[model samples]
Target: MFIDSDIKEFVEALSSKEPVPGGGGAAALAGALGNALVSMVGNLTVGKEKYKDVEPEVIEILKKAKELQEKLLSLIDEDAQVFSKVAAAYKMPKNTEEEKAKKQEALNQALKDACKVPVEIMEYSLEAIKLQRRLAEIGSNLAISDVGVGALLLKAAVLSGKLNVYINLNSITDKEFVEETKERIEKISEDAEKLADEAYQIILQKLKIEK
Candidate 1:
């Protein structure tokens, strides 16, 4: 698993010619790192004299942020696995009509699975960005920049996930499925952009206040 490797090893593996740890895995990893930062900001905010007023909320944010970090990290492998399945499906033999039908069926299902994995990743990224928005509002001023950085990372992850979704959707023969997935992707992409920008601006404003 990519997660089992050390940082240098993971980078080397990702840099290799293998396609398993491609854009999907990278996006999930980025989102995981982003949410970790959000958790750190919440942790930094929750136990301080100056931040007492927001401590309760920060504690809740910290709890959820930890959960999200793990969930996004898990997606890294899931994304790669599903994509691999799709790749394998494409390589299946299709010399005969029966074989062609079987291959088509497998490819359709694999593409759907591949699309779904990235959709889940985008969902997680949205959640991380929302947490970051809350952190920018109530997190400790000392680490507010972390919240901004995390929010940006989450947004980038969402966009990356969207790319994977679109590519899969284009190959899917089910128009209904493609349309449905596209709708969700568009909404998440729009909202993620809005929330990320708002959260980042809040972080910057907080830094100015601190000055």
Candidate 2:
């Protein structure tokens, strides 16, 4: 997983003619970054005299954001690994009837597993966006910009995740599964966009009317 590679190596891998750390991995990282920003806002709101009334609420949001962030961070690697598995399944031998059947089964299972990872990312990122909206309202005023950053990151996550969903949807042979997954992805995309827009507007309003 080479979790601690230097910036140069990571950038090289990301830019090199490789596809492992593609859209799915990027979406996972974006989602994690979004949660991280929300966590920062929540942490800054705690233990401040001016924000005492909202301290308890901020504490809860911080806890939840940290949990979500950890999950999403882990998914960054999981998404890449799942994609690699799908690629490997595609390389299965298909010479004989038995080999063809085995390849088909492997491809089907691999596609399903790959879809699950991005679907999970989409659901969690959607929740993170909702939390960012709430945090924008009661978080530290001084740190409202970070809430805006969270909203942006979540929007990136949503769009990036959609790309992963689109790519995986192509491999699915079951018509029902394809239709259902497409519907779910569409709904999530709409909701995530709306939430991100609302959060951004709130940030703008807060900054514009700052006393």
Candidate 3:
């Protein structure tokens, strides 16, 4: 696993012609930012005089959001590393029949692993969007904008994850595996869009409308 410093170097690599920190890495970062925004809303609601009755629940939400954020941040590196592995597998020598079969198997497995990571990212980001919607309804009035921000970030994550899934699907040779992944990604993307739209409407209704 890459450390924080390594992640910085990875981002610099992204700035060049590198492909590892492409869509997959960007999706992970979007998910992390979404989770972090949800944590911010939770923190803002906790220990406040008006929100005292819900303070305990806010604390729990804050803890969970923080944990998810940390996990998503780490996934940024994980996604890049897995992508690099897939690239390496593709580059393996295959002059002999046995070596060709072995390299193909390795490439297939690497592609699967790469696909799974982005799927996990999409799932986690959808969960974060759900949390943002809930918080927008009951969170501190002043912090509703943060909930909106969370929703937006999750939307970005969902779209970014979809891009990674599509790219990986092009490399996958298994029909069943590709079909299953496509179905799952479609469902999650639809749900994420709905959640983000609802969050946007709620925030506008709550904070932007003139009383």
For model 2, residues 150-177, the per-residue Cα lDDT tens digits are 9999988988888888788897787798
Error of 1 at 97 (Å): 2.1
Model 2 worst lDDT window (10 residues): 2-11
Evaluated against the true structure, the overall lDDT of model 1 is: 0.89
lDDT of each: 0.89, 0.86, 0.86
Model 3 quality (TM-score): 0.90
Off by over 4 Å in 2: 209-211
**Highest lDDT against the true fold, candidate:** 1
Q: Estimate the TM-score of every prediction.
A: 0.96, 0.92, 0.90
The candidate with the higher lDDT, 1 or 2, is 1
Error of 2 at 12 (Å): 2.5
Each model's RMSD to truth, in Å?
1.9, 2.3, 2.5
lDDT of 1 by residue, 162-185 (tens): 999999888889899999999999
lDDT of 3 by residue, 1-211 (tens): 4336566776686677867667787888889888888888888888789998878877877877877787788888889889888989989999999999999889888999999888889988998888888888778998898899889989999888988888888987888999999999999999999999999899988876653
Q: How well does candidate 1 score on lDDT at residue 67?
A: 86
**What's the lDDT for candidate 3?**
0.86
